[model samples]
Target: MGVHTTNGIQGVSVSDDARNASARRGKKGLLIGSGVGVVALAAAAYVGACYHYKDAIPEGTTVAGKSIGGMTSEQATRQVLTLKHPNASTKANVTAGDQSFDLAPASAWKPDAEKTLDGVTEFSLSPGRLLDQINGGGEKIEPVYSVDKTALTTLVKKAAESKIDGAPKQGRVKFIGGKVSIVDGAPGHGVDEKKVADAIASGWPKKTDYTTELVEKNSDASDNAVQAFAEGDAKKAMSAPLEVSANGQSVTLTPAQVSDVISSTTGSDGKPAIKVDTEALLTTVLSRGDKMRVPAVDAKVVWKDGQPSVVEGRSGKEIDESKVAKIVGDALVGDHKATLAMKEQKPAVMAKDVNVEALPSTSMAHFESPFPTGPSQQARIHNITTAINRLNGIVVQPGEQFSLLRALGYEFTKESGYVEAGTLQGGLHLDGMGGGVSQVSTTMYNTAFFAGVQLDEHTAHAVYISRYPMGREATIWNPGIDNKWTNDTGKPILIKAHVESNKVVMDFYGTKKYDVATRTSGKYNIQSPKHRTVKNVKGCENTVGGGVPGFDVDVYRELKSGSTTVRTEKIHTKYKPDDIITCQN
Candidate 1:
């Protein structure tokens, strides 16, 4: 029994040992598996971090719609760009640093004013493209490239060699006749390659061409039959013989070996060559003797319509109709003849009809005339006629100024025969011809005062005299000083003057459009006039009592609707004491 119990104990021990060994092996295997799993997880995490932190961008990396990864600069910039979402809310923030600018992205994006923004450079981004990048959507983006000195130099040289420098200049290629011509390197019109390329790059079209003139030279012929023959045309060649210098030497034409003269010909479009009909051309040249006279063109000047016209003058005389017809026919067929001949003739000249605008009849109180027609009846008539003719159809526009110098250009020339006389303070005077013409000027002033024209420039005489209404007369001198006025009334006015045997009258004509009426006020503050003397070939004499008393005169014009003075001007003329000069010869 004791032996049996020991064996049982040993067996129990063996079983426990086996079970512990198995547990130890299982535990070792589980620990190895756990260690392996932890290492694998760590390795995977490391690989993921490496991928996330990589410095080199891989292929197919992109922003907006453009490819940006591992691409050469040229390949990266292969897309056309346009401003996207023109109406999109966009705000540009331009940030400037010391040497560079950071033009921030637009809030959205839009095109700026084309004119203002043309040729401007800026660095910028588009927010719409950024949003698109975040959404994995296709994008539109403006691109930028570096433009340093080296790159610009290379680009310019390449462009010049290609399209600008060697390219045909605009309009320089002139195709006339049949040949292509170009005035090479004409400065102002020459080609500039850089400008052209920039225009093309900026979406502007290149200029094409310009128009220019072409000229050819031709002259009368030469001699030395051989020399003339070398010039080609025989007829024009022998028209004038060439004059050689005093040294006797004949100019030689053919050196025996020269055969190209017969083939010379020229056309603008065709190739230039020397071609001539030597046989027939020589005959024409020899037939013409010295002194080629261009036949006289028969013509006559006659009254056609109202103007003089030149025609075939041989009409009423011994005119050969066939000969005249032949001349005209040849003229029409000439190589260099004007196309429209009839229009070149001067047509007729006619006077315009006198048109007087009808107006309400005005009547002035006719009284016993105090003014008298003085001596020199012929002179008075001539002055009155001249003044009348000048005043005929004279028109005054409202607000337009009238100058006496312009009107009296007639009185200053030698044709009027007026001589130079000394001026008195500001008075008009003449020594010889048309001496009394100032009578017309005085008449015009009186009429204008009543007609109500604005007085602009006027001068008073140094001395006063008779034959003129004391202070109411106007005096004018030639080439120097005169009276002037403006047509201030809103109406056209005409001055008509007429002189008969003993009377001179001036009448103003115009529609009562402005309702203007003028009147002279009281003549007051009269001063005793003075005397003047003149010395001629004989002696001096003082004329007495003829000098009129100086007086103050007031003239006014009433602008009215019915019976009212809308505007009034007071013209005060205080005639200085008269110095009546008496001439004694």
Candidate 2:
């Protein structure tokens, strides 16, 4: 009986426990279902919101301060396009100095409605719109613009050009009619183009009228400034008589003369300055031949009896221009009596300072040529001797060039001490003044050639002369042909020439540097002489002038220092055939 009772109690307990477990399960299922229903409702709300605003701008969308929320992209674009922008017909007045220019505002900047609308459309599709639909905020779109920079710059430059003046001129001194005067400088005006351009670029659409003044630049010495500077000096210079004494000689400069030299000027430092015109003072008051103005004599090298001799130069005492001006200026203002400033002017070539020892002691090259003997030839010899005397003893310093024609004046008439003699004209020997001078030139050229001097200018004669070396002679004519040579011996050269018994000798005394060897390519390119007939009857003779054959030749000169050949030079010459003239009556 006890066992059965215990079993019944345990069974009842077990059944009760199972019922509690099932009730708990039922409660958990109900809570989960309720939560799922809440989630589904929230998702549906989000989807509905997205669908409602898909084709429309978010609620908070704004463009150019205009609200376009809840509108489609097309509607927003239209709204933005209708917004007010800068007017195209507006005009701006720009001023520079007294000039004014009307600028067309439309030309500088233009409003782009299509671009502005496109910007608004871009904003609508942006992720910020979604945030705007949720948070009720939007982007503020600005209007886009296009600018014509070149047109704007041109307009600004034009306005500046019309009113701009040239640059200022500095003051200077002027001497006119024995009077000292000061020329004043003038100021200039100019406009700043860049400033005007910048103003237009920044404030064009906002401001309609822009006015600017031209900048004024002051000159270095204005009228008032220069006048003040010269007033005291000029008054002092024109006050009383100025006296200057030098070397026991005295000269008194009247107030008028002093005033003539006193002037105002601008110095290198760009300041008003007082100056004295020394040239005017010297010309008006101090004569060049005055005892205080002895002329300076240059030293010279002369050939006396075929020997090089130096003529000592003499320095002359003269009034120093600058120092005299200062002393005189001070005297005019202070004491009214002053001694002139004296200075010794030294000769450019001083005897003692010259390198006479370096001069060539022995003759490096010598040339001698004989002339036809006759009374006419003697007259020609006289002229040639005169020219040689003029050139004798002339020293050619290293690197110095000598010109034969320039040394001998161009005019060969009797006034120039030249008598009629034999000359070549148009390939015919004729009597003319300065005819025998060719002999001198030919001798000098050969001498220079052997001396290794650099030949600068030289020309061969039209027809070869038997007296001169073949292919090595030169001729000179006034105003055209010239014989020139440079003294390249690195030492001074002394030229000595003499005429003796129908023969001329030219010698160059210089340091021997090179031995020159000349080679001649025998004459080529031979051309036959042409026969020319003449009708004059005075000296009727057949073949009055003999014909000469034409030919071309190349002469090569090789210069040698000791045994080594330093340089080789080629001189090419082409001679035309001499015409055979036949005289017939």
Task: Give the Å error, residue 50, model 2.
Answer: 99
Q: Give lDDT for model 2.
A: 0.67
Model 2 agreement with the true structure over 411-439: per-residue lDDT tens digits = 46576688877777776656777878888
TM-scores vs. true structure, each candidate = 0.33, 0.41
lDDT of 1 at 328: 25
Structural RMSD, model 1:
38.0
Against the reference, the lDDT scores of all candidates come to 0.39, 0.67
Misplaced by over 4 Å in model 1 are 1-375, 417-430, 460-470, 514-526, 529-541, 544-546, 580-585
Residue 261 Cα positional deviation in candidate 1, in Å, after optimal superposition: 73
Per-residue C-alpha lDDT of model 1 across residues 1-585, encoded as one tens digit per residue: 113347356423346777789899999999999999999998776555444323222233432322333222222232112223322233221111211111112221223323222221122134433333334343223333212333333343233323322232212222223222332321121123234324323321122221222122121111232243333332222223221111122222221111221232223432332333333322232123111111122232233464443333111111122333223222222321211111121111112111232321352111111234555355545554565455433444333355554454434333543433222332223344444456666666766665654456665544555556555667665434567765444333444455655555676654332356667777688787555555562323344456656767776666564675556766667776655667656
